[model samples]
Target chain A: MIAVLAVVQGDIGIAGLAASGILVAVAIAISLWRQLGLERSLLWASLRALVQLLFVGWVLQFVVDPDDPLIFSVIWLTAMIGFAAYTTSRRAPDVPRVLSLSIVAYAASAVVVLGVLFGFGIYDLEGRTLVPLAGMVVGNSLAATVLVSRQLLIAANEQRDLIEARLALGLTAKQAFQPHLRQALRTALVPQIESTKAVGIVFLPGAMVGLILAGVAPADAVKVQVSVMYLVLGSVATTTAVMSLGISRELFTPSQQLRRPTQRP
Target chain B: MSSLDAFELRGVDAGPAGSPILKAIDLTVPANGVTVLAGPSGAGKSTLLRLLNRLDDPLAGEIRWRDRPLIEWEPTDLRRQVAMVFQRAPIFPGSVIENLRVALPGVSDERAGHVLEHVGLDVDLLDHDAETLSGGEAQRMCVARALLTEPAVLLADEPTAALDRTARATVEDLGRSLADSGVAVIWVSHDTDQLRRLADHVIVLADGAVRATGHLDELDASDDQLVRRSVGAP
Candidate 1:
């Protein structure tokens, strides 16, 4: 794939390869230094991601060189979105397997939000335009899912007796969980809101950083960053909402019983 | 003239080391009145009370409530209709109303206030977090929570042991009043004086078996060595 892409798109030479290798080594050293006393899992995950990304970079060189790049890009992004949904739901068994719904919700929201801002004849489907925006949406949604699931689980466990008592007192299961459910949803969304508030002053986000590095003007990079931020926020909210609703329904039966956690043999 | 005898224990044996806490015990408490389980420490009094609520199942024989075997009772329904107050009050975190609300979902704030009053708790204490309440106040809230269910039986294990003398007397009074209002009260306590003061009938246990069963006065009149010794007779 890398050979084919080199033939098609001119050469991305040994210089590019050396730069990537040197950047990766530096990133690893920095991460290991920062995580000095922590568990080895972080270091292990970084190494795995590096190897996986290199493999993916080789494969994408061919996939992106195809006659129909748009279709290939759609397929690639769809796979990312689908896997994000699956990983998030599996992490929270209490969440319903709304894989299809989450995919549609996230993909449709991301495309609309990203496409309008980028596809408005202002920006085109360049690698710089598409890849970073998708990464923001996919990554944020995964984190949101984690936050939502952890908060919901804690709220549910802590208030179990109160929930049972409420059920006995003639409230439906949904009614019993309503307060905590709302709280969990709020907790999941708040961090994203705070980051959005901190956009230019507290930190320059990844999209702007990448665009600025690629020699785009500061104002232009900030504009693209703003659009990407909206896409990310929208996609994550839709995915989290659909997932939260589905997970709540799946975790509890219509008769208001909690589903037993799936046991392994 | 009752809502059916809500509980029955027959040949029930429970305790540690194969030595039953309540051996071959048979009891049918009336649907109303304070049924004091008066015994010394380790006499299986608490165990017998727990069995009524199915907190612990009998080792041998059976326990039934409303003609249905205790084991067959739906756990949720059983819990709702039969509330157990532990020896030391276990107040879960949350407001006083939240603690009271634990047994009855959708119980109105007004009704919670009423139940609190009925359990001898001041209405002002409703919004206070239960964990911070004094032992007596917490125990009263436990009773209030149980009462909110309109439970057929209240199984209390040493509900006042951790309270001061004034608080203990207050809780004992509340238990008697609850029985007077037509709820079956099965209370376990080692305080013979409180049992005599509050119980309509007493079931005394020495080891795991019933050593004496009758009204408090009858037990007092009897020549049982434990009772004689307990009464401080020389």
Candidate 2:
């Protein structure tokens, strides 16, 4: 565990970690001053993040070792994808087959991204690089995947008359649903695209900032950050595409009728 | 089934489970002339019209289109032969001609103009934006779009319900003319005036069941007061 702390330039001892609690204190103080009613939520979220990150950090020690079998990295990536899919389904329970569709989206994006990074020799084929890169890809794509799924469901429910009108005109479900699917995909992808466009100017991204804080040269950090940004964008696009198309298919019957989504209980 | 029948329903039950909107409905829609489905709101007139085009299916029993079971016909093919026009007249975001092209893609300008004319719309309105049309014109345009498929039957679910009096008359005339042209017009109307003017044959529905089926003259002469009142019979 100490070696894990040493992987970064300097170890943040227990005292340093406690000292960082001042930031949370400031956020809580602001919430209290504003009467925002977010004091309990802020406290709970901070504690939750601390425990979750520490657990992840402890687990990464064995897996992130370069000497460990690459299988460990693959297993870690699989678990992350599974959890992402589960979270997406939980967020959008109204979407039919969301769990399976999300799995396809996350798994496909992971393969495309990691394959490009390693196969193209952009990053070394080791658990140390593979785990973090795949983690970034999955974590970044999870929100977008959920957005695409829920957006399509919203489109189907809200524009049902329009869809049925198209269906009544003899258009197949796929043809009738194409416009809404495109709209949902656009709605899901735009946030990520805008974030990518404004990455360095508007706000420094977390990965690049973390690297710079760990004493990496700014130029080298920029190179890694640019690659990571591109991969995140690519992964988001791929995941949303898979999710929108797959969910669109599920929203219809084989007879080309749009299946009305049942109201969530 | 009579050869002149367009749709034949036997023991049909419909609507969401446990609360059917149509129940044990045995009826036949004629292959020619206007057949108005006259009922109060929630009487399942729209639901019955939806069944004719396979927009919906009965929970029980069978529907036959032109003597063939509805389940046996491909849904898209069925819809092509039996097109529907909705009440709100949902206009796709495009020109009038573009909306028509949705029913028959690659529709020529001449054919588009002809269908528009058939619906009493001006040929010049072809290039006009569909979303900008008045309520009457939009409903007429929807009728023209359905006509592009050259359907044998037109299921109009209260097609003029949202229109002003003049617009309602125009769409009513369109329905009458379409039926005169040998397209079986299955019209749903709650307006008794529209019923008196347009119903060549009437099916009166109440509480999700058929209360009467006959001509206005015969229904007016019925012993049942409800049947007489449903058709607005004097």
True contacts kept of each: 0.08, 0.61
Per-residue C-alpha lDDT of model 1 across residues A1-265, encoded as one tens digit per residue? 0000112232346687556666656666776778754335555766688689889888677555535467667677777888876876577555445455456556765676667657675556655346556766777788787677667666666665555445443345676577677888888888889999998889989867765666666777677677767777787777677656655665565445443343100
The prediction achieving the highest lDDT against the true structure is: 2
DockQ for model 1 equals 0.11
- In order, how many clashes per candidate? 6, 0
Interface RMSD (Å), every candidate: 5.9, 0.9
Q: What is the lDDT of candidate 2?
A: 0.87
In candidate 1, what are the lDDT values of residues B89-191, reduced to their tens digit? 7565689987766566578889999888888888999889888888888878878877777777778888888899988988998888878887778888777
Candidate 1 wrong stretches, greater than 4 Å: A1-50, A61-138, A147-187, A212-265, B1-5, B8-30, B36-114, B126-132, B145-152, B155-158, B161-165, B188-234
Model 2 clash pairs? none
Error of 1 at B181 (Å): 1.4
Error of 2 at A146 (Å): 1.9
Docking class of 1: incorrect
